[model samples]
Target: MRYERVYVIWDLYDGVRTGVADLDGTPHYFASQYDEGPDDYSDNFKLYPVGTEFMRRAARNWNIYRAWERKFHNGETDLKTHPGHGGIDAEYDELRSWLDKQVVLLEALPSLYRAKFRELPNQEGLPGGMLRELEVTWSPSPV
Candidate 1:
C-alpha cells in the first residue's frame, strides 16, 4: 500500500512548530516540504500518541489547534499564536525540540517511503532564500 506521512510546520514569528501523527498509518514513511495549490492549503501536522506525557500533551495541543483550524476550512483563518502576544510562550522551545525528534525519524525512512512525500505537485512560485515558515510532511508506522 502507498502511504504519505504529513507534518504541518508552523513558521511562526518566534520559531517553528512541526509535528507528526500516524493515527492509522503503516510503518513505512517519508517526510518533505508541504506543497499546496493556490486554492487549497488546509492541513496541520497531526500528532499521534508516541512519546513522553509532555509530548503527548503537546500533540493534543496540536489537535486543539486543528479543531480551531476547522472553523475556517477555507484556509482564511490564521491559527498562529505569537510569543510577543505574551512574552514568547516558553512552550515553544519544548515543542520545537520534540518536533525535531520527529524529523529525525523521517530522515531515516527508506527511499521508497520518501518518494511518496516527494510526489507533491504545484511547486511553482516558491520564493528563494531562507525559509522561516514551511510545512513538513512525512509518514510513519502504525501503532
Candidate 2:
C-alpha cells in the first residue's frame, strides 16, 4: 500500500508523541501505537503530506529509532558497560544529530510542504481547531 500522508499524534505538554500512520497516511507496518495505544484515539494531531526526501528520511530514521530502542531496552541499560556500547552509542548519536538537523531544517524548509495541526477542546477559555502550520519535530521518547 502506498502511503500518501503521515499522521502524528503528540503530547503538547510532555513532547511524548508517536506517529500513527505511514509515510503516505496508512498505519505503520509494524504493530505500535498506531495499532493499539492510548494515542490511537487522540484528537490532537499534526498531519503532513509525503512530499520531500527529508520527510521520507525522517520516517526511516523513526523505524531505526524503534529498533534501537527495543535493543537498548531489551538487553543492556548501562551504556557505559554494554559490550556493544561503541556501536550503540554511535547509532544513538547519529539519531540525535538527525533530530538536531531537523530542527535547523524546519526553518529553511517551512515552505516545502504545508503542515497542519488539530487540537482538542479544552475549558481553559482557549479555542481549538486547525490552527497554524507548525514545523515537524520528533522526540524519540518521553522525557
Candidate 3:
C-alpha cells in the first residue's frame, strides 16, 4: 500500500466530528489523511468539504445552484436540461481562486507547522513511547 499524506481541506467552523463546509468562506481545517480510514467514499464526496470551493455558489445564488446540484447528483448532464450547469462551472472556477488564496495563507504561517505536522504521533527518530511524553506549543495563525 502506498503511504502518503493527502491534502484535504475542511471548513474549520464545522464541528469537530464532521468535515462539513459552509460555502461562504475559506476552509478552516486541512488534514493530511483521512481521520479514520480505509477509503471512505461517496458520490457526494466531491460536493462536501473536500470540494468546498465548488460549493461557493449556494450562498450568492441559491436557486441556480440548487437546480444544478440536483441535476448533477441525479446524473443529468445535458446542458439544455440543466440550465444551472453553467453556473456551477463558473463557481468552480471561483473555487480554484479561493484555494489559491488559502495556499498563500497557509504558506505565510511558520514553516514548522508543516514540518511539525508530519512528525505527528512522534517526531523523527523518536521512540514510539515518546509519543506519550510529547507536548506541543501551538498558536493560531495571526495576520
Candidate 4:
C-alpha cells in the first residue's frame, strides 16, 4: 500500500480582536496551522510591536517555508534556488533565524508588558503568544 503526504496550510492574520475594537485599537497577530481537518489549529493572536517590517517579512518568509516544505516532502526536483538570493533551504533557514531572534526579543520585554499577553481575558481569536512568545507589547488591555 502507498501513503500520501499531508500539507498543512499555515496562515497568519493581524487585526484587532473582535468586540474589542473600541477598547484597544492596536492589532494583534496569530498563526493558523491546519489541513483539511475539522477544527482550526490556530494559536491565540498576540501583538507585535517590533514594527510592520517584522510582520511583513514574516508573512513573506512563511510562504517560502510552506512552498519549500511541500517540495521537500513530495520529493520535487525544483528544490533549487528560488526567487530569493540563496537556495530554498537557505531561505527557510533565514526565516527560522529571524523568528528565533524575534522570540528572544519578546521574552526580554519587561514583565509589565509581557504580562498583558497572558492577562487577555477573552481568547476570541486574539493572539495568545508570540510566534511562541514574541507577541507585541501594548499600553492598554483589550478586555
Name the candidate, 2 or 4, with the larger TM-score value. Answer: 4
Give the number of the best model, judged by lDDT: 1
RMSD of each: 11.8, 14.9, 16.7, 14.9
**Number of the top TM-score candidate:** 4
Q: Could you tell me which 10 consecutive residues in candidate 3 have the lowest summed lDDT?
A: 108-117
TM-score of model 3 (CA atoms): 0.27
Query: Candidate 2's residue-wise lDDT over 1-143, tens digit each?
Result: 22133333322334324433343333331112231456452323333333355455555555554444455555634345432344655654565466446544432211222223233335344223222222232222221
Error of 4 at 54 (Å): 0.8
Candidate 2 weakest lDDT stretch, 10 residues:
107-116
| For model 4, the run of ten residues with the poorest summed lDDT | 15-24
TM-score of 1: 0.33
Q: Give residue 60's lDDT in candidate 3 (0 to 100).
A: 39
Expressed as tens digits, the lDDT of each residue in 41-85 for candidate 1 is: 223233334445434555554554444445334354443643323
lDDT of 2: 0.37
Clashing pairs in 3: 12-28
Displacement of the residue 19 alpha carbon in candidate 1, Å: 5.3
Q: For each candidate, give its TM-score against the true structure.
A: 0.33, 0.33, 0.27, 0.34
Tens-digit lDDT track for model 4 on 5-93? 11111333343231111113332232222323556532333333334555555666666754555555456635454434354467666
- Residue 109 lDDT in candidate 4: 22
Q: In model 4, state the lDDT of residue 78.
A: 54
TM-score of 2: 0.33
